[model samples]
Target: MTTTPAAPVATDDVRLSAREAAERHLRALVGRDDARLREDQWAAIEALAVDHRRALVVQRTGWGKSAVYFVATKLLREAGAGPTVIVSPLLALMRNQIAAAERAGIRAVTINSTNIDQWQPIHDQIHAGEVDVLLVSPERLNNPGFRDEVLPRLAATCGLLVVDEAHCISDWGHDFRPDYRRLRTLLAELPSGIPVLATTATANARVTDDVAEQLGVHADGTSDAAVLVQRGTLDRESLRLGVVQMKTPEQRLAWLADHLAEQPGSGIVYCLTVAATQEVAGYLRDRGLEVAAYSGQTEADERHALEQALVDGRVKALIATSALGMGFDASLGFVINLGAPASPVAYYQQVGRAGRGTDEATVVLLPQIEDRDIWAYFASLGFPREEQVRETLAALAESDRALSTATLETRVELGRNRLESMLKVLDVDGAVQRVQGGWVATGRPWSYDAERYARVAEAREREQQAMLGYLRTTECRMRYLREQLDDPEATDCGRCDNCGGLTISASVSEAAVAEAGQRLSRPGVVLEPRRMWPTALSNLGLDLKGKISAGAEPGRTVARLTDLGHGQALRALFREDTPDGPVPPGLAQAVMDVMKDWSPEWTSRPDVIVVVESATRPTLVRDLADGLSRVMQVPVVGTWAIRDASVPPRAGQSNSAQRVAAVRRRGGLDADVPAGATVLLVDDQVATGWTLTVAATAIRAAGASAVLPLALAAQG
Candidate 1:
């Protein structure tokens, strides 16, 4: 949507000083006659509008970072400059910014993943000077067509460049993004005299300096005049920071159910995982709270609707992951984290969402022991090893044509998400180029930068340690966080728990605890069978292609390994130090519950049970099959053995193609199958589902009419 055009610059307005004009614009933007620009905000706006200087603003959230750019855009456009180009990070932020721009009578339009059809028209408007501000995602910066075509003209003509969440440009930032690093190329292409503004509330001193350096580089690869770095105190006086130590996931849920209604207004309840969001939101809703789950997995339309719901007070809270971290604007009364973030800087950013437009808001952290495990899981998705990177580059170099990510997956052992992330970094480093079809090697020399990656990893570990320290800290929470961000003006915030300005009850009602316990302990997760084989399996010496002719029927698992309830138990049972043994009685009962819940959907019970040999937990797999066989009154059949014991375990394989190839290479089903008999296949756990799929294909090939796959836990 476009904003209202600016009112004509009157003869009298033309004579007004820049500061006076900025104050007038601020009054219009805030829709208050008395509204005035804060000194820092005005300074930032003037730097860009009057001085044509690059600036980085690292003030706290809700500090009017958007106002600096929008006001500057108005001043620039009114003086015959082209529209400002804002490389925003999220659609929610774009929506908020567009509305804010409209308030200032600055026309704004956006091009993001949500509006592919409108991109051309939006670009047309941009070129025609009909749009006063253009907001695009950082990913769009490297689009084949946009980067090769539209960006040059935009860079040459754009009056101002704005990078929201500028911390993402540095690897040291808590929310580092490889796509943001592409801004270096964009900055290099811009003509001289164009002003740039990078804004983020989450950056620490290191990130601030790195972003400033990146912002100051000239088109000639030389450092230009120092960038104007405007950082302010990060303390939020309106926030009442506190921490409630939770011994169990159930207690955390109960605490939320017990006190959510007491919170002043609708806010956010942040979880570390998408599964947790659904779990927590469901439990809260069942307890009569109006809440919904939000994450990257949520559809675009639903995310928008849920955001509006929270804004309109339709929902008490939106249980979410980091997907809701940036650009979500609500005068939230509380923000509760069910688990702690790995970094205090990231934690500060999420908590910043609260108390933005309110006089006072509650910010609480309910730290769990499992948070470290969750942190480790996320850290594992970072840049792949040097060997994996080299393999990816070699694959691209040898290919005659550009290889799609799916195709490349068969050639290298990196998951799709990690592979795509690496490709973006490579593209930014000039070692690869993304064209119309996919990605191709540019034949540019590239180094792995092992030392740099090690430093990043070390920094991450230190941040994680600091987060743990936050959990144990007895000092003022706000002051501790501000100090972590290197805020020179940090002082004890008397509004936190330690300072006695706020007191939160740690007790949860017995009834709520019992109900929460029941919800978390509930078992059973649907395991949808794989229908299609991975593409280009031949690259890995596999003969598979297209849809599988012999696939297992839909099955059931006791629970996802990531589930807050059974997940915790499963994690304990499957720890690396945990000894292999027969299935525990409790877990066996849960498996039975899963079966009972799933029985209604099955056409018939299986005739026989078979076990997929587990190299890691052979005894556990066999015992699970034997127990199921006795319970279901189905005879225990022969085992499906791994043909070659020396073959490497499937755990080491990263991508789907590699896992499939590894499973197929070890021959399947060793025993004869009764023709037309249904077979029950049991495994300890299912991560990629490839092993089960390959084994089921073998069972079906042995003339079984149907194969039913069962696993104790499914990886989320």
Candidate 2:
């Protein structure tokens, strides 16, 4: 896909003066009668309205990036151009932009996943010229129906095309989306005189160049036009940054509980994972703080409510994951990170949400030792393997009919989300197409581009390393982050802790730490049983599909290995380099406590204790089972032994299908427990729970009435 620019139309050659119109639009947008357009904002509007040339604006967050587009849209519409089409990335962003447009008296509408019911009506409005701006998600550009039908119409008549959060168009950007790559097609198809504008607040120099190139700006005269690049300093003078190194997650939680109320106003607390967000928010709420957990698992309506609550200062903060990172709008008074993000670029973007309109905002980072482990977990889910891609292509080529994602799952081993992500990347590469009901092979030549993917992966590792350096750096902390983004004019801000010596206190009260320890140490997380079998198990020679014939009983784990409190200890105990031994005395004691405190929902008391025999860590499994048996005063039953010692281990199983196949073939029931007896089943660590499920199924079939699984730690 090529994104060459159209020829530049000089300002003098333009027929209209957009400066006065832009100022009028800005006043309405900010609700100030005397509001004036900033010079950069007016320049961008003039380029789009008068000069009809593509422009990329890279500025700091809260620097009126939205104004450039809104004013440009108003001026273009008044000139009788087609409605402006904006390719926005996030739902929150769309909501904020639409509201901003309404303030400026521009008729704006959005087409996203939430409002499919109104898509046709919105389409009608666009065609009837009743809308001034139409905002669409980047993912919509690849929808077969939308691309084939609506996109052509949009391209033919669009007044101007705006790519919001344009950094996502470049792989070098901290947050890259495969869907944004399809903007090349949209850009190439646009009419000759229709202008384009790409806006972002977090891009560094490298990302700027990549985005500019994608828009057809090249060093040699290869493009149809030249791209006008406008970049500004990224320094956020209102943000006072600091890092507090906490030896333990408990200390971090204790600090927050003791000090969150001291913060100036409502803000955000970012956690690296969904589980962490829930745990942190729960702990804060227990301390009588007004806060809520927000993550990808949060329902749409609940997310909206939480966003509103934070905006209205009803809650102290929203403990959130990166799901709440971008497009969230609030002049938040502070931003705190439970642990560092994988990269400084991402870190800046998350914290940038704070102090947008305030005189000062506190930005603190509480670095944890387990951050690397969390980073590794997410890194494992990157681009699919070339073999997997080939398999997907071959599978699609085998049939003439289109296949939905669910149906395709039968033939591919990838999880549903991963499969969809791969398909999208392939679609942009022209190897596949999303049809009405599903997907079809385009039969176009496609290469895996191994070198490029490998390079990107290597870049991610470098970013992770840079984040560690940022935590330890003594030079200005804000400058460290800015330098990572390739900000050329980066300088010491003299505001961060490194520049201004420990602004946030490192000490936490003993009472708070004790309370935090008690809360975190109260173990046992409910382990829900796997309800449905992985789809298309039959394709893998297993006669399993839909719901399982007999699902395993809900089980309990002492704690998630990723839990902030027990996580560090549990992780060290389970490290690959750690020598295997019988269960540690302390962990064993914790296990007993977990059993003693098991909730009433775990109604079935075990009469017999059975263990899933382990080949890799036999001593650990046996010792744990023996300890549990002694505590429960139950007879130790036989084991669910491995059928073949040579069977591959399930240690690194990444997806469900491979995990199911591995566990089913390697282990089986050997216990002879009495009928109608509840069995206490024990295992070392449960990652996907397939081993536990397989063992439980066998035990039940072998005469046990029920199985209650117990594990040392659960790996989420």
Candidate 3:
């Protein structure tokens, strides 16, 4: 019903040609995709593509960082670029990204640990310009063959390099990986001037600087030019951050269960150690709750299963270490920390894991007082002394040539594992050159001086102390993050342990038993050992002065006796008057009781009766009297390794040992026992009864009158 309309005449007055008109029309045909049309997101996309070719997006966790890359990748595909290459550290992320891209009808594939062995096909596709995107890992890029094979081909196509969790390039980040260093080398192999877009939830000034320098964008190291898109405040009105200091591990777990019972929302329970992770998960599982555990040692298949279970809600709570949080996207309503996180960066990362897909989430940290001391020990992380360094360096210098770390360490008396860390430190300092099996000393002294080492150790100690200080940080945790990001207008985000319901009590001076403290340095009258025995007497039963004559002249005096089974400390221990001089008063009774109890009705032979104080916790014998008093009724004694327990955990052992001998009669357990005697041994728990069984054996061996185990809890 229509007639062809005459073609409109072009104003070709020495101007608009038909081709120019067609170009104009094609240019206008490029319409904005609705997928990225959100006002803020579109602004970000346009700013990225047209305004800033290289950008750093500091978005919160699960703010759709992948979406940003998706829009970019699609635009590039539309422009007929050869292909896009994405360098992703997490294999799960690569898979998810590939799926998302495919769902969006964009051709994309992954090349990483899972498929590096069969990378030939993927490489071929890249060479053929068949791939729309290739996801990679830093480790894969580290391979010379892989880089040479794929980078050049894709570099010619000139798409883009998207880096996920790029903060790892900085040492300040929690999960820094050395393989990330090789990324620049891969970039060099790729087409010149390709864009690099890196994203992370937590990168501070130091991290941003490191990323820029490592990527070569910070040539001349312009720290200010580092691209960062600051995301505004997120909605977390429902989150409640709470922290609790517990006295024991079991108590912490029990408290956690009770808290979970109150809410019972989707959550993740993070454990500091792998053993704890499994045990906690097991406890939950035993309580008829679903649980999946993740640790560094977990198998790849198991990790994948657990992660999927987390996403699917098949598992109510996933007990994991920090390793499980990478690239995991779960709008988990709650995240719980079983102990103090090793670093503030870790704390932020773990807490950020919650409230991903939802507006409301909660984070809880159960800080046990016992763990405070443990973490404080790590906070004072020790590096070997310069003497240790010198010893190690001397060993390295003397090494025949080209030795591995393991081999080099064996040559030193400082110990192999402990000695090697210093060597690596020297290597890092550029004082030594490592080639193959051994290190060739640079002959350039690492300024080998004690002061320099001291400074370096101090710097490390300060950094750790800073992390420890976070435990007592009064501000909300999110505000802490803002401070780390170097923002000027920061506020206490009001969803942290301090801002929530945690109320701190003012320190009150104690009036009762203030003088009962175990401080040995308080000004006091000269405190001397009891005159009942010599001050120099050992903890074990022994006569430091003269051999205790078993049949000494009878008198009510602190007399020593030989073969009474009393330890050297018995020489100093108080003695009760006996018919035969003064015998270690209660010691003889304990030995006799152990002998009789071990071998029902057996009279005990004289055995060492040392009064060791109650050693409820494992500690040094000298620093604090631990495990000093024991019932001599047991045949065998418990010995402590002479190694100094007082030394910091990181420092090597002091090489000390303490022995506990059995309190038993020379006669077997079947021997007759004297009437009207009493003995008791205390334990926290009697699990499996093996400890009691062995105690009976020791009592019989020590010639104890009897052995009776009185534990708080005994299993039938």
Candidate 4:
């Protein structure tokens, strides 16, 4: 069958053709007659074709950011100035590059503490200006003896310097490294105007900016264009995002066994803990589901072998962590997020691993309600505090022996990246020793535990505020999320708690569709004046007395977050049990009375409307929506929409507020809606009711003869 090629997508950004990129690399590696290249490798090659003196390659993990630099190194190498130097983060990646080079008949070498002996010749060749390229880690560069010897020797003849996994430059990076900052100076010491190329497949816009800024590059030359450099959206159109709501880990395991037996594909099941990873992998393997486990604790060779097994069909399913996805390709059909993914970034990166090289794929996000509070507490910690770094440094200096990050977590209360950052900074100062296997302190002492602990805790509080802001912002969740990551399609999950809690899910009947409208309910969870259950109950008794309803919303209950709740309450409310948890004493009555007696601005249809403003990271919104839905389960209409009021609109209408009002004339609004579907207005609550009145009217004129409004609250 003859097929027509798709029209080039008309994006403002320039895209590189794989053929052009490969041809350029082939010419550069002219002497290597056996260089085999894939389309992805060529695309990366073209992306690395730099006009600017310094370049950064941020492609998808498997999109070959290394090849881009490797090919560029090949070009720069044959130019015959001096040997090129590569600073990589991992020993495994360096080994991968060396192996590929050897296979291609080109010379390459790596220098990490584990393989320091093999690097002796590489150091001599670099000093003598005879080697083609040398790869080393940043920790090695900061070595006092190596600083006086290997780096200075190579800097004299080095033509190009490449730093791989450049996202580590970001303070927000999953793996931040302070050692990276010092490498910026090595180029200035080099003679040939050694242009640096930093590369990664994972940096978001913020990380990208940090990387360029840290490298001291103006970054104006870096295209503002987003290449489809990250893995393609793997929410496969052909694969359904199946969901299994479970209470305990065991139930999930049982569910997986049965489900895979019914519809199996080379698959992956992810767990947040190493113990869980082993448990799941072992359990599945024992149960006769070909399985393997991958975690940070797994040996590099073992992890790589598991990845290969997934691809080669040696294992039909692998239970692993984020370690499996960064740069492996598996033509698998399924992935299951066995727990609430930590963040949208982490989730995207992990789920992206599935469906690669396949025509289609599927992902299942299995949720545990118990995970919510932990996630909330987690989101509360957004960024690492400077004080935390300072404190960590002091502790490391004081300690005589080296310690692993995991060990410090127990000895100290450090957030994930906070611990990684301090260790990275210590490595830069040469005050810490990165042993053959782990990290340890080198100096006599700096500061003890108490003072540093307070500083880090205080800093964490500040970061928690920022993370709370992201979760609670009163703007279009899509635009808000984009502002955070500068990427597209983040707000797509239809099942997030946020999406489920939307006005549509709670709005009143179709008969009252024209009367109600949607809005954001404020001061949620911890950040605002939270309407706690006990407090509301006590207050209602003290204040409203007879106004509250005793028995209502049949077979429904809610667990509300007060300004504060002890672990005992949290566990009782969230831990899987009997369906939905109970709201703090009187809060349930408050929500019920509010939904039943509270009037939405408009009227005609359903009793409530649920509107999930954002879907990117749906945990918060979904929780509110689902909670409200369960309470007002009596057939409410749900509306899925995004409200980005911040981006100034076209012509006179500057934002969503005025534009949505103007929409009253057209089919109500522009994106897309069923022509005759009724419009039931929804919002978290109505303070003055202006937003509801406006939204309801607009949707009414759009089609619905009536509009109904509903919310979590209503004012006097």
Per-residue lDDT for 411-442 in model 2, tens only?
66677778888998898888988888888898
Q: Which ten-residue region of model 3 has the weakest summed lDDT?
A: 520-529
By TM-score, the best candidate is 1
* Ten contiguous residues with the weakest lDDT in model 1: 1-10
Ranking by lDDT: 1, 2, 3, 4
Instruction: Provide the TM-score for each candidate, comma-separated.
Output: 0.97, 0.95, 0.59, 0.52
Residues 566-606, candidate 4, lDDT per residue (tens digit)?
Answer: 22243454344624422444444444544454334224324
Question: What's the lDDT of the predicted structure labeled candidate 1?
Answer: 0.89
Q: Which of candidates 2 and 3 is the stronger one according to lDDT?
A: 2
Predicted model with the maximum lDDT: 1
Backbone Cα, N, C clashes tallied per candidate: 0, 5, 79, 69
Error of 3 at 705 (Å): 33
- Candidate 1 has a TM-score of 0.97
Clashes of 4: 69
Model 1 alpha-carbon drift over 4 Å, by segment: 1-16
Candidate 2, clashing residue pairs? 3-215, 3-216, 4-216, 5-225, 6-225
Report the lDDT of model 4 for residue 607. Answer: 42
